[model samples]
Target: MTYEDLPTVPRAEELVDKAFSRAARAGRAKSGAEAQRSMLQTAGNILSDNLQNVTTSWPDFDRVDPFYRELADAVVPAHGDCPGGVDGLRTHLSEVMWAGRQAGHIRDEYQSKLRGVDADLARKHRKQAFARLADVTREVSEDLEALGEARDTLKTLPDIRADQPTIVVAGYPNVGKSTFVNRVTNARNEVASYPFTTKQVRVGHVERDHVRYQLIDTPGLLDRPEAERNGIERQAVSALRHLADCILVFVDASAECGYPVEVQLALRDELADRFADIPVLTVCTKADRSRDLDADAYVSVTEEEGVEELLDAAVEAVDYEIELPFEG
Candidate 1:
């Protein structure tokens, strides 16, 4: 489900240069029509294999986890010249695959033409085949560029494990969402920017009773309504819908967070309706400053008060059951 291991995508010109350069070396090792045939086969195989590798390196969109699939859809196209949507990305991949097959076909056809031909004629046919192969690659240059851009964007995404129970911490700006997550989880939270957005996301983990729970705090998403968000942010929230097993809707009852309690409650209600199947807990933060509002839990990160209790409540709400082996 992670894109960190995806291979770096090479440009069309790089692939072509590599293929032709190796073909020349392969040609030097033989004579007559054999030399020409060797060169053609060498170049063709390199181009075809490399081009195919680009496509194979990407996971099948249909089979990918819905969370990552949607995240990619939101992030990839926002940076580069890639077309929007998963379908558009698939189209670019299909083109690369087509070009790879074309390279193979060109090799086979030129090999046939080499039969019964002298060294000079064989050399001429090999050149023609090389030209055709390069042409095929050049035709899909934009596709290669788009896929390369996608690789760059997707690789930078924060590594959020889909297998573990996830608690998404959300609230308005300065509502102490990040502070609360930092307090509850380990000291080291992985922070990374979402592609095409100025805001960053923080992810942390807490282990209890031999099981791990993930806590993610995303800015610029889940803090505002869908109508107020841009396309990229909206899609990101959509992706979170698939990943969040439980959501902690933090409300700064003190109004010191710069947002009114009523507004925060409305957002909580909206999230509750949107993720109807998931547990949405309303937490009143900055308890030391003020506890003027009612919530499922209250916490003050500054004083380290009620934090553990809040964490226990979130973990219990997740209710993740670990499967045990059956007795023989």
Candidate 2:
């Protein structure tokens, strides 16, 4: 909840104000009896209204639904037969406040570490590397446009030519990354009926406009696990770690690995962490239907999707490797 929702008990204010007024007008209570009585009355007032301030001042508990339930349970005992009563909610709120602050601190600490060498790299030659890729991407786009027009004019399709025609279609499995390779490259590869079924690597190549990209369809990635016992995944990670240059990360927004868009974000963070500076692209493969997942990184490849655009993005994605001395 926002700051407005936090509880605000007037404990010191009520006690101080009355004491001040008596001191200003009637002078100090010489016997200290009046002072003791005033203190007791103020304490009673503080106890009576303490619950309202506690509940109101506490941040919104909507995100942590269980916390609110606990607060209600704590309140019911003291307020059993009374109207708008309050019990141990203040004590509970105190606990909640401590935990919340601790969580915030932890979250902020970890998030700072996740940003990577982006800042230092950005300052040095990393920015230049990305800028060079962007330039190449623009150039490739213009070249593709010319090629498309020429193909239409000649009524012929371009074919990919490679020595081995190895295409490593890297992405999270179940995103039809293999299926796209099979369809476009016409590779005789297995198309799984389930997630992570293509537990092996398959490579194929398709050429367009005299450009041949060997599509290597790789096993799915479970970002959380390393020794996941999936050989295909091991091979895929090996490629990501040491072999491949152009990487495509497939996402099934419909099939959220966890209940949040943040989970997918975490997956992205893992990818960026593992493969820094690699040319990676995102493929939204399950666009045939809508899922609640909202991602900033993807080129859609669903039914009636823009295959050309996807291909174009793929071109741009790989241009990073092409402009470099690295060979995929």
Candidate 3:
């Protein structure tokens, strides 16, 4: 389900150069007419093999986790750079693979034609084979470049466990979401008072009553509507919606986080609408500086208060139940 470990995709020129260079070395290993024939076949085989590596190394979009699928599906083409969305990427990747397969066919045909040819003519045929395969390589260059851009985009995707019961923390920027995550779970991820400090989802784990649970620290969701969100922000939201077993919607009751309670409430309402499948446990944060506040849960992360109680609430909201040992 993780793409960060995938092998690097070579640029078009790099792929071509590597194939030709290796072919030359392999060609020199032979003598006379056979040298040119060996070189031609070797060059074609290298090109096909290298391109095959790229296609095989990439994760099959259909076979990946649903959370990953949603993330990939959310990737929009860069403005004026690529022309289509996730399906476009899928088609381009297939095209690159097709070109690779064609290279092998071209090589086989030239090798057959090499039979009974003189050394000088064999050399000519070898050059012709390289040119033909090179043309196929050129046909796939744009798709390769697009795949490269996809790799860069996918690098930002968070590493999350699919089996665990996950609790996603969400609210407007600077609403103590990160602080709450740090306080409740073993995760010591970065916590700051600044807005948008968490640009991606961060995961942590904790055990309660002998059962483990996952805590997700999501990027702060702005109060604005979904239309205003850019691609990166949309991807983060996709992770939350697709992965959360339960959601902890933090509210800044003290209004010290610059954004008002109304704005935070709007965010909570939006989340409720978007993720209707799971229960949203609304919590008021910064209780130390709080006056009157209204929420289903409340906690002061700075004062180390109500942290476990919040975890207990999240554990209750999960859809499944676990059996603990008998008190006897």
Give me the candidate number with maximum lDDT.
Answer: 1
212-303, model 1: which lDDT tens digit per residue?
99988766343565677865565447545877888988888988766678888888898889889999999998899888887999999889
Taken over the whole model, the C-alpha lDDT of each candidate is 0.82, 0.46, 0.81
User: What would the TM-scores of all predictions be?
Assistant: 0.89, 0.42, 0.88
Supply the TM-score for candidate 1: 0.89
Task: Write candidate 2's Cα lDDT for 1-328 as tens digits.
Answer: 1122222233333323443344334313322333333332332233223322433444444443332232232222332222211233334444333433433343343334323534343233322322332232232232223322322322211122223223346655566777777767666667765777665555666666566676767677666677553544665665455445566666666664222435555666677677777765655656665444554344344464656666666666666332447677
Q: Score residue 231 of candidate 2 by CA lDDT.
A: 45
**lDDT, residue 100, candidate 1:** 94
Q: What global local distance difference test value does model 1 have?
A: 0.82
Steric overlap count per candidate: 0, 15, 0
Candidate 1 residue pairs in backbone clash:
none
